[model samples]
Target: MRQAPVSLPLGIVVRRTPSVSRWAPWAYKAVSVIPGAGAADWQVLREDGDVIEYHAATVPLELWHTDTEAYLAGLSARVPSIGVVMRDDDESAHPYEILLATASPYECQDYADSGEELLELVPMPEGLVALIRDFVEEHHEEEVFVKRRRDKKRIDEVEDGRGDPRITQLTDVYRAPRAGRPN
Candidate 1:
Protein backbone atom coordinates (compact mmCIF):
# COMPACT_ATOMS: atom_id res chain seq x y z
CA MET A 1 0.00 0.00 0.00
CA ARG A 2 1.17 3.46 -0.88
CA GLN A 3 1.52 5.98 1.88
CA ALA A 4 -0.38 9.27 1.72
CA PRO A 5 1.50 12.40 0.76
CA VAL A 6 2.90 14.46 3.63
CA SER A 7 2.57 18.24 3.78
CA LEU A 8 3.93 20.75 6.25
CA PRO A 9 3.28 24.48 6.47
CA LEU A 10 6.51 26.35 5.84
CA GLY A 11 6.92 30.10 6.28
CA ILE A 12 9.45 31.53 3.87
CA VAL A 13 11.55 34.43 5.10
CA VAL A 14 13.06 36.85 2.63
CA ARG A 15 15.85 39.29 3.35
CA ARG A 16 16.34 42.54 1.49
CA THR A 17 19.42 44.72 1.47
CA PRO A 18 20.44 47.87 -0.33
CA SER A 19 22.00 47.09 -3.67
CA VAL A 20 25.29 48.63 -4.83
CA SER A 21 24.15 48.92 -8.44
CA ARG A 22 22.21 51.98 -9.56
CA TRP A 23 19.79 50.03 -11.73
CA ALA A 24 18.21 48.29 -8.72
CA PRO A 25 17.89 49.84 -5.29
CA TRP A 26 17.32 46.68 -3.31
CA ALA A 27 18.52 43.07 -3.49
CA TYR A 28 16.21 40.32 -2.26
CA LYS A 29 16.82 36.67 -1.39
CA ALA A 30 15.13 33.96 0.64
CA VAL A 31 17.08 33.51 3.87
CA SER A 32 15.28 30.87 5.86
CA VAL A 33 12.20 28.66 6.20
CA ILE A 34 10.14 28.38 9.41
CA PRO A 35 8.66 24.92 9.83
CA GLY A 36 4.99 24.83 10.95
CA ALA A 37 4.77 28.60 10.92
CA GLY A 38 1.41 30.29 10.38
CA ALA A 39 2.29 33.90 9.77
CA ALA A 40 0.55 36.38 7.47
CA ASP A 41 2.12 37.12 4.11
CA TRP A 42 4.62 39.97 3.76
CA GLN A 43 4.81 40.52 7.50
CA VAL A 44 7.97 42.20 8.72
CA LEU A 45 9.91 39.83 10.97
CA ARG A 46 13.11 41.65 11.84
CA GLU A 47 15.53 44.35 10.78
CA ASP A 48 19.26 44.67 11.39
CA GLY A 49 21.27 47.57 10.08
CA ASP A 50 20.21 48.01 6.45
CA VAL A 51 18.96 44.42 6.12
CA ILE A 52 15.26 43.66 6.53
CA GLU A 53 13.71 40.21 6.78
CA TYR A 54 10.06 39.48 6.13
CA HIS A 55 7.81 36.46 6.30
CA ALA A 56 7.12 36.53 2.63
CA ALA A 57 4.68 33.63 2.39
CA THR A 58 3.48 30.47 4.05
CA VAL A 59 3.32 27.55 1.62
CA PRO A 60 2.88 23.82 1.98
CA LEU A 61 6.03 21.71 1.60
CA GLU A 62 4.56 18.59 0.15
CA LEU A 63 6.32 15.22 -0.14
CA TRP A 64 4.73 12.68 -2.43
CA HIS A 65 5.58 9.00 -2.61
CA THR A 66 6.27 9.34 -6.34
CA ASP A 67 8.89 12.03 -5.67
CA THR A 68 10.84 10.10 -3.06
CA GLU A 69 13.87 9.83 -5.32
CA ALA A 70 14.13 13.60 -5.64
CA TYR A 71 13.61 14.14 -1.92
CA LEU A 72 16.26 11.53 -1.13
CA ALA A 73 18.75 13.28 -3.41
CA GLY A 74 18.03 16.59 -1.70
CA LEU A 75 18.36 15.11 1.77
CA SER A 76 21.69 13.51 0.92
CA ALA A 77 23.25 16.80 -0.12
CA ARG A 78 26.14 18.24 1.94
CA VAL A 79 23.97 21.16 2.94
CA PRO A 80 20.37 20.07 2.81
CA SER A 81 18.36 22.89 1.35
CA ILE A 82 14.77 23.81 0.54
CA GLY A 83 14.03 25.66 -2.68
CA VAL A 84 12.08 28.93 -2.46
CA VAL A 85 10.63 30.17 -5.74
CA MET A 86 9.58 33.81 -6.04
CA ARG A 87 7.96 35.19 -9.14
CA ASP A 88 8.46 38.68 -10.50
CA ASP A 89 5.36 40.83 -9.94
CA ASP A 90 5.62 44.38 -11.19
CA GLU A 91 2.07 45.28 -10.12
CA SER A 92 2.54 44.42 -6.44
CA ALA A 93 4.09 46.62 -3.76
CA HIS A 94 6.97 44.20 -3.48
CA PRO A 95 8.98 43.51 -6.63
CA TYR A 96 8.75 39.76 -6.11
CA GLU A 97 5.79 37.47 -5.34
CA ILE A 98 6.53 34.50 -3.09
CA LEU A 99 5.70 31.21 -4.78
CA LEU A 100 5.84 27.68 -3.30
CA ALA A 101 8.60 26.16 -1.15
CA THR A 102 9.95 22.83 -2.40
CA ALA A 103 12.40 20.27 -1.07
CA SER A 104 13.14 18.75 -4.47
CA PRO A 105 16.19 20.18 -6.25
CA TYR A 106 15.02 18.87 -9.64
CA GLU A 107 11.80 20.90 -9.38
CA CYS A 108 13.81 23.97 -8.39
CA GLN A 109 16.15 23.44 -11.38
CA ASP A 110 13.16 23.34 -13.72
CA TYR A 111 11.88 26.69 -12.39
CA ALA A 112 15.37 28.21 -12.51
CA ASP A 113 15.86 27.06 -16.12
CA SER A 114 12.78 29.05 -17.18
CA GLY A 115 14.54 32.35 -16.23
CA GLU A 116 11.16 33.78 -15.25
CA GLU A 117 11.35 33.23 -11.49
CA LEU A 118 13.99 33.82 -8.82
CA LEU A 119 15.20 30.68 -7.07
CA GLU A 120 16.82 30.59 -3.65
CA LEU A 121 18.27 27.66 -1.77
CA VAL A 122 17.76 28.00 1.98
CA PRO A 123 19.12 25.60 4.58
CA MET A 124 16.51 23.09 5.68
CA PRO A 125 15.68 23.01 9.38
CA GLU A 126 16.51 19.95 11.50
CA GLY A 127 12.86 19.11 11.96
CA LEU A 128 12.14 19.30 8.24
CA VAL A 129 15.21 17.21 7.55
CA ALA A 130 13.97 14.47 9.86
CA LEU A 131 10.48 14.65 8.37
CA ILE A 132 11.67 14.36 4.80
CA ARG A 133 14.12 11.63 5.77
CA ASP A 134 11.32 9.64 7.31
CA PHE A 135 9.12 10.15 4.27
CA VAL A 136 11.87 8.91 1.97
CA GLU A 137 12.61 5.96 4.21
CA GLU A 138 8.99 4.94 4.09
CA HIS A 139 8.35 5.41 0.39
CA HIS A 140 11.67 5.09 -1.42
CA GLU A 141 12.33 1.86 -3.32
CA GLU A 142 15.61 1.14 -5.02
CA GLU A 143 15.30 0.51 -8.73
CA VAL A 144 17.46 -2.19 -10.31
CA PHE A 145 19.73 -1.03 -13.12
CA VAL A 146 19.03 -2.87 -16.37
CA LYS A 147 21.56 -2.92 -19.20
CA ARG A 148 20.04 -2.93 -22.70
CA ARG A 149 21.55 -5.47 -25.10
CA ARG A 150 22.15 -4.47 -28.69
CA ASP A 151 20.28 -6.29 -31.47
CA LYS A 152 22.16 -9.14 -33.23
CA LYS A 153 21.20 -8.04 -36.76
CA ARG A 154 24.08 -6.47 -38.77
CA ILE A 155 22.88 -3.20 -40.37
CA ASP A 156 25.96 -2.95 -42.69
CA GLU A 157 25.08 -6.23 -44.48
CA VAL A 158 22.19 -4.69 -46.44
CA GLU A 159 22.52 -1.96 -49.14
CA ASP A 160 18.80 -1.35 -49.47
CA GLY A 161 18.25 2.35 -50.47
CA ARG A 162 21.78 3.28 -49.37
CA GLY A 163 21.85 6.36 -51.57
CA ASP A 164 19.75 8.40 -53.95
CA PRO A 165 18.18 6.07 -56.56
CA ARG A 166 18.53 8.82 -59.16
CA ILE A 167 22.36 8.44 -59.13
CA THR A 168 23.61 4.94 -59.92
CA GLN A 169 27.22 4.22 -58.83
CA LEU A 170 28.79 0.84 -58.07
CA THR A 171 31.71 1.85 -55.81
CA ASP A 172 30.38 4.98 -54.08
CA VAL A 173 26.59 5.04 -54.12
CA TYR A 174 26.46 7.92 -51.54
CA ARG A 175 28.97 10.19 -53.41
CA ALA A 176 27.46 13.54 -54.50
CA PRO A 177 27.02 13.91 -58.29
CA ARG A 178 29.72 16.06 -59.92
CA ALA A 179 28.62 19.28 -61.63
CA GLY A 180 29.22 17.80 -65.09
CA ARG A 181 27.75 14.38 -64.29
CA PRO A 182 24.05 13.70 -64.96
CA ASN A 183 21.77 12.73 -62.07
Candidate 2:
Protein backbone atom coordinates (compact mmCIF):
# COMPACT_ATOMS: atom_id res chain seq x y z
CA MET A 1 0.00 0.00 0.00
CA ARG A 2 1.22 3.48 -0.89
CA GLN A 3 1.34 5.71 2.17
CA ALA A 4 0.69 9.42 1.97
CA PRO A 5 3.35 11.89 2.97
CA VAL A 6 2.27 13.44 6.22
CA SER A 7 4.22 14.93 9.10
CA LEU A 8 2.99 14.29 12.62
CA PRO A 9 4.02 16.53 15.47
CA LEU A 10 5.04 14.21 18.28
CA GLY A 11 7.97 12.95 20.33
CA ILE A 12 8.99 9.96 22.43
CA VAL A 13 10.58 9.44 25.85
CA VAL A 14 13.23 6.88 26.73
CA ARG A 15 15.05 5.92 29.91
CA ARG A 16 18.73 5.01 29.75
CA THR A 17 19.27 1.95 31.87
CA PRO A 18 22.61 1.38 33.56
CA SER A 19 24.73 -1.12 31.70
CA VAL A 20 24.57 -4.58 33.23
CA SER A 21 27.63 -6.75 33.96
CA ARG A 22 27.62 -10.52 33.98
CA TRP A 23 29.92 -10.47 36.98
CA ALA A 24 27.88 -7.97 38.95
CA PRO A 25 26.49 -9.05 42.31
CA TRP A 26 22.85 -10.15 42.47
CA ALA A 27 22.00 -7.29 44.84
CA TYR A 28 23.43 -4.67 42.48
CA LYS A 29 21.64 -6.15 39.45
CA ALA A 30 18.41 -6.32 41.35
CA VAL A 31 18.67 -2.66 42.33
CA SER A 32 19.49 -1.59 38.77
CA VAL A 33 16.11 -2.73 37.48
CA ILE A 34 14.39 -1.56 40.66
CA PRO A 35 11.84 0.07 38.26
CA GLY A 36 11.83 3.40 40.05
CA ALA A 37 15.51 4.32 39.93
CA GLY A 38 15.84 4.31 36.14
CA ALA A 39 12.70 6.32 35.55
CA ALA A 40 14.59 9.57 35.90
CA ASP A 41 15.78 9.19 32.32
CA TRP A 42 12.44 9.94 30.69
CA GLN A 43 13.01 12.64 28.12
CA VAL A 44 11.33 13.58 24.88
CA LEU A 45 13.15 13.40 21.57
CA ARG A 46 12.94 17.17 21.58
CA GLU A 47 12.83 18.94 24.93
CA ASP A 48 9.86 21.30 24.57
CA GLY A 49 8.84 21.72 28.20
CA ASP A 50 7.40 18.16 28.13
CA VAL A 51 8.29 15.62 30.77
CA ILE A 52 7.12 12.19 31.87
CA GLU A 53 5.82 11.94 35.41
CA TYR A 54 5.92 8.72 37.47
CA HIS A 55 6.52 6.34 34.60
CA ALA A 56 8.49 3.10 34.43
CA ALA A 57 11.91 2.95 32.77
CA THR A 58 11.49 -0.31 30.82
CA VAL A 59 8.38 0.26 28.73
CA PRO A 60 9.20 1.77 25.34
CA LEU A 61 6.65 4.00 23.60
CA GLU A 62 6.33 4.26 19.84
CA LEU A 63 4.04 5.42 17.02
CA TRP A 64 3.16 3.32 14.01
CA HIS A 65 1.84 4.40 10.61
CA THR A 66 -0.71 1.66 9.88
CA ASP A 67 -3.23 3.15 12.34
CA THR A 68 -3.08 6.55 10.66
CA GLU A 69 -6.49 6.25 9.05
CA ALA A 70 -8.22 5.13 12.23
CA TYR A 71 -6.56 7.95 14.11
CA LEU A 72 -7.66 10.50 11.56
CA ALA A 73 -11.20 9.16 11.37
CA GLY A 74 -11.56 8.80 15.13
CA LEU A 75 -10.05 12.18 15.91
CA SER A 76 -12.23 13.81 13.29
CA ALA A 77 -15.38 12.18 14.68
CA ARG A 78 -15.46 11.16 18.36
CA VAL A 79 -12.21 11.25 20.31
CA PRO A 80 -11.47 14.74 21.51
CA SER A 81 -7.76 14.18 22.15
CA ILE A 82 -4.82 11.76 22.31
CA GLY A 83 -2.76 10.15 25.09
CA VAL A 84 0.84 9.05 25.81
CA VAL A 85 2.59 6.61 28.16
CA MET A 86 6.04 7.26 29.60
CA ARG A 87 7.86 8.05 32.80
CA ASP A 88 8.11 11.22 34.86
CA ASP A 89 11.90 11.75 34.70
CA ASP A 90 11.84 13.45 38.05
CA GLU A 91 12.50 11.78 41.36
CA SER A 92 9.50 9.64 42.22
CA ALA A 93 8.67 6.11 43.34
CA HIS A 94 6.38 5.27 40.44
CA PRO A 95 8.38 4.36 37.29
CA TYR A 96 5.57 4.32 34.71
CA GLU A 97 3.49 7.14 33.29
CA ILE A 98 0.36 7.92 31.28
CA LEU A 99 -0.11 11.39 29.88
CA LEU A 100 -2.78 13.08 27.78
CA ALA A 101 -2.29 15.50 24.92
CA THR A 102 -4.56 16.88 22.21
CA ALA A 103 -2.50 15.59 19.31
CA SER A 104 -2.56 11.80 18.69
CA PRO A 105 -5.87 10.00 19.03
CA TYR A 106 -4.76 6.96 17.09
CA GLU A 107 -1.54 6.35 18.98
CA CYS A 108 -3.27 7.13 22.24
CA GLN A 109 -5.96 4.53 21.50
CA ASP A 110 -3.38 2.02 20.34
CA TYR A 111 -1.53 2.15 23.63
CA ALA A 112 -4.77 2.31 25.60
CA ASP A 113 -6.01 -0.90 23.98
CA SER A 114 -2.87 -2.86 24.93
CA GLY A 115 -4.75 -4.08 28.03
CA GLU A 116 -1.90 -2.88 30.25
CA GLU A 117 -1.51 0.73 29.15
CA LEU A 118 -3.88 3.41 30.46
CA LEU A 119 -5.38 6.43 28.69
CA GLU A 120 -6.50 9.84 29.93
CA LEU A 121 -8.72 11.69 27.45
CA VAL A 122 -8.48 15.47 27.29
CA PRO A 123 -9.81 18.24 25.08
CA MET A 124 -7.97 18.37 21.77
CA PRO A 125 -5.84 21.48 21.37
CA GLU A 126 -6.50 24.17 18.83
CA GLY A 127 -5.14 23.60 15.28
CA LEU A 128 -4.71 19.86 15.82
CA VAL A 129 -7.50 19.28 13.31
CA ALA A 130 -5.84 21.45 10.71
CA LEU A 131 -2.67 19.38 11.04
CA ILE A 132 -4.64 16.18 10.53
CA ARG A 133 -6.91 17.48 7.77
CA ASP A 134 -4.39 17.30 4.99
CA PHE A 135 -3.25 13.84 6.00
CA VAL A 136 -6.79 12.48 6.35
CA GLU A 137 -7.87 13.88 3.04
CA GLU A 138 -4.91 12.24 1.40
CA HIS A 139 -5.37 8.82 3.00
CA HIS A 140 -8.96 8.29 4.19
CA GLU A 141 -11.40 6.79 1.76
CA GLU A 142 -15.02 7.14 2.83
CA GLU A 143 -16.71 3.79 2.52
CA VAL A 144 -19.80 3.75 0.30
CA PHE A 145 -22.60 1.86 2.03
CA VAL A 146 -25.26 0.16 -0.11
CA LYS A 147 -28.50 -0.76 1.59
CA ARG A 148 -29.92 -4.21 0.71
CA ARG A 149 -33.41 -4.02 -0.74
CA ARG A 150 -36.17 -6.31 0.47
CA ASP A 151 -37.89 -8.54 -2.11
CA LYS A 152 -41.42 -7.20 -2.73
CA LYS A 153 -42.74 -10.70 -3.44
CA ARG A 154 -41.77 -11.99 -0.02
CA ILE A 155 -44.58 -12.05 2.57
CA ASP A 156 -44.41 -8.92 4.67
CA GLU A 157 -46.24 -10.25 7.73
CA VAL A 158 -46.46 -13.57 9.59
CA GLU A 159 -50.24 -13.51 9.04
CA ASP A 160 -49.66 -13.42 5.28
CA GLY A 161 -48.88 -17.20 5.40
CA ARG A 162 -46.30 -17.39 2.66
CA GLY A 163 -46.53 -20.32 0.11
CA ASP A 164 -50.19 -20.73 1.17
CA PRO A 165 -52.07 -18.17 -0.90
CA ARG A 166 -55.53 -19.19 0.41
CA ILE A 167 -56.88 -16.72 2.98
CA THR A 168 -58.78 -18.15 5.96
CA GLN A 169 -61.14 -16.49 8.44
CA LEU A 170 -59.44 -14.79 11.42
CA THR A 171 -61.18 -17.18 13.84
CA ASP A 172 -59.67 -20.11 11.95
CA VAL A 173 -56.08 -18.89 12.18
CA TYR A 174 -54.71 -22.40 12.81
CA ARG A 175 -57.25 -24.50 10.98
CA ALA A 176 -59.88 -23.98 13.70
CA PRO A 177 -58.03 -24.11 17.09
CA ARG A 178 -58.50 -27.93 16.97
CA ALA A 179 -57.51 -30.18 14.07
CA GLY A 180 -60.28 -31.70 11.91
CA ARG A 181 -62.79 -29.30 13.58
CA PRO A 182 -64.96 -26.83 11.63
CA ASN A 183 -64.98 -23.17 12.72
Best prediction by TM-score: 1
Q: Cα RMSDs of all predictions?
A: 4.3, 12.8
Candidate 1 lDDT tens digits, 1-183: 776778888999999999999999899989999999996678999999999999988998988988989998899899999999999898989778888899999999999999988899999989889999988898889988999999998878645446766776775557555567676
Winning candidate number (lDDT): 1
lDDT by residue for model 2 over 90-171, one digit each (tens)?
A: 4564344434232456565666677664444434444555545545565556667899997788565444223334865543
Residue 172 lDDT (model 2)? 38
TM-score of 2: 0.37
Question: Where does candidate 2 stray beyond 4 Å?
Answer: 4-9, 12-69, 76-79, 86-94, 97-114, 147-183
Query: Per-candidate TM vs. native?
Result: 0.84, 0.37
Number of clashes found in candidate 1:
0
Report the C-alpha displacement of residue 3, candidate 2, in angstroms. Answer: 1.5
Candidate 2 local accuracy as lDDT?
A: 0.42
Can you give the lDDT of residue 114 in candidate 1?
96
